[model samples]
Target: MDDPVRAFLEANHGAIMTTLKKDGSPHVARVVIGLVEGKLWSSGTRKRVRTAHVRRDPRATLCVLSEDNPWAWLGLETTVTILEGPEAVDQNLALYRALAGEPEGLDEYRRAMTAEERLVYEFTIHKAYGMH
Candidate 1:
């Protein structure tokens, strides 16, 4: 259809639970994500399994279930880029706050997080498709 990757993300902007094995195989879990600058972004602690997989392999696939038809699904293959610096954190925090609808005191929460503790991973869409 019309760029299923962007369509899927626009329809569902939430965390997407992704699976990545040490061997480089990947699986995707639907999760809430924040969209900014035409990219899909998510945050997680370093202790999480997905975080570990991303650390090993930045390539990931994301899938979102279709609401109009439960039998349908959209999938995207993307390259993940992990942001771990101050500036990147700020940008990601702004996007996160906007997506979360937390207007007040988000800056404080973002400031409390350390650069490493806050993982801002961006998924660059490479290919996308869907099936019904």
Candidate 2:
């Protein structure tokens, strides 16, 4: 992603992500996104249907919108890679910090994430279009 696009995404955390279902229908959900390691990242759990969908189909799209202006948005065609286990926990923490800053009780947070079976959806931008 370019600097302007990255900055726009940073300023706008809320987006609607599209993933494909088993029948090839679109499943859209609101997600909080952030740039992590030069890629867009969102946290999910193993139990969620979205997780299953993404795992099954790596292709996805994210329409990131600006909270302040309805006219401003960015649409990203991306491919997702699921991260789990210890590496996922570390990446998830990095994502959390990137989006929301540092959290209190880091250890507790990690424990909770592990208990919840948290995973990270790492998005590689394939194409993008929108008004920055």
Candidate 3:
């Protein structure tokens, strides 16, 4: 990644993620995504349709526009792996902190995650496009 691209990704920008539905259609969702340790990942639950689609097909795409300039953006075509174990919780929280700063009400979120399910989808970038 170039300097400008890396800076843009570091900012708090909204990301759009696309996954293939059961019928082979694209299912797009607005998500919080972060580039961590040279890879991209998104945190959420196992109950979402996005998770289901990813489970069925690992191929996905993520796009994020520059928070500084909307015209500038990053696009990535990736293969996703759903980490579904105890480590998912801490890993997802680490990604979340990197993207959204430290959570104020972490206890509530932890309870909810425990009640529901917290999963992290790690993305391996196969192809990417962005400006330097």
Candidate 4:
């Protein structure tokens, strides 16, 4: 396992397209990610379809490929764990601040979110593979 993969993920916590199955086929969609305590964290709005699918099945695969180098890819297969309530909300806010360069007004943005509106999910990273 390369340590840089984790570092890369933390530094570039952008949208990653996770693939799951529906009706014996595959479905891929982009999602925002946060790195909290070395685990991959994400959330979904109530309107997002992925949230519903995840509830039904927690298994997912996340792929992050380098734009400048196709050969360089980081992939992980893991089970999703949903985190709800106040603790999750605070963790998400902290993650956002860390990955988003600690931008100004972040405190206000985090403060504006209600406890119910924030849904945090983490991937345990059961297995990870990559090529540099």
Candidate 5:
């Protein structure tokens, strides 16, 4: 991610991410976008359709609308890497705070976070487009 895309992502922009289902259909969802170590990242539960889709196929796409101009947007053709373990929960926290801001329910959030199986997906951009 770079420039306007990065800036848009850093702001309160929502992302529409898509993954391929086993039947070769697209499953789309609004997701939290984050930058970890300067790379774009997203997350979801392992039991979810999107995560399962990613486990089967790494290909994905993320689209962010420019906050400055509603008509302008950026889309990325991306591949994902799944990271799991205790650190994955921590990664989820970082990604969550990136979009949702710091929550007042930190302890509750941590407890809830610890209960789920998480996949921290790092996006590798293969192509990008800025739609005017």
Candidate 6:
């Protein structure tokens, strides 16, 4: 990715993630996404339809919009890996911090994530395009 696109991704957290349904239709959701270790990351529970869709199909598209400029945006075509279980707790926390900074109640937040069975969706970019 170019520096400008990387910067745009790092600066924005709100994005639209599109996954494939079982019938090959599209499933889209608004997600809080961030750039971590050169990959795009998002946190979701296993129960969510979007999560299930990704679990079934690794291919996905992420559209990140500029909060300040309506015309500025970035679209990424990627392959996703779902990270869950005990190891995902810390990974999800890191993603949360990257997107929103330190939580006010770190321990409580961790507990909630564990209780909810949260997972991290890691995206590897294959193609990128858009106004950005």
Query: For candidate 6, lDDT tens digit of each residue in 71-124?
Result: 989999999999898988899888877877898899998899999999999888
Q: How do these models rank on TM-score, best leading?
A: 6, 2, 3, 5, 4, 1
Ten residues in a row with the worst lDDT in model 3?
Answer: 4-13
Q: State each model's CA lDDT, in order.
A: 0.68, 0.91, 0.80, 0.69, 0.80, 0.89
Best by lDDT: 2
Candidate 1 lDDT by residue in tens digits, 1-132 = 255556666666643556679765656565667677766777766676777787788788777666566767767677888876666667667676757655567667766666357767778878777782
Instruction: For each candidate, give its TM-score against the true structure.
Output: 0.75, 0.95, 0.86, 0.78, 0.85, 0.95
Could you give the candidate ranking by lDDT, starting with the highest? 2, 6, 5, 3, 4, 1
In model 5, the Cα lDDT at residue 109 comes to: 81
Specify the poorest-scoring 10-residue window by lDDT in model 1.
Answer: 1-10
* Candidate 5 per-residue C-alpha lDDT over 40-127 given as tens digits, one digit per residue, 9 for 90 to 100: 8887787888888899999999887666778877788999888888888788888777667787788888777778777688989988
Cα lDDT tens digits, model 2, 75-132, are 9999999989888888889999998889899999989889999999889999999987
**lDDT string, candidate 4, 3-102, tens digits:** 8877667655544656455664557887767677666888655446666667778888887666566567678887888776667557777667666756
Can you tell me which runs of candidate 2 are displaced by over 4 Å? Answer: none
Candidate 3 structure, TM-score to reference: 0.86
Candidate 1 backbone collisions, by pair:
14-31, 14-32, 14-33, 15-31, 15-32, 15-33, 16-31, 17-29
Give candidate 3 regions above 4 Å deviation: 1-4, 130-132
Comparing candidate 1 with candidate 6, which one achieves the higher lDDT?
A: 6
* Candidate 4 lDDT score relative to the true structure: 0.69
Model 3 clashing residue pairs (backbone): none
For candidate 1, give the lDDT.
0.68
Q: Is candidate 3 or candidate 6 better by lDDT?
A: 6
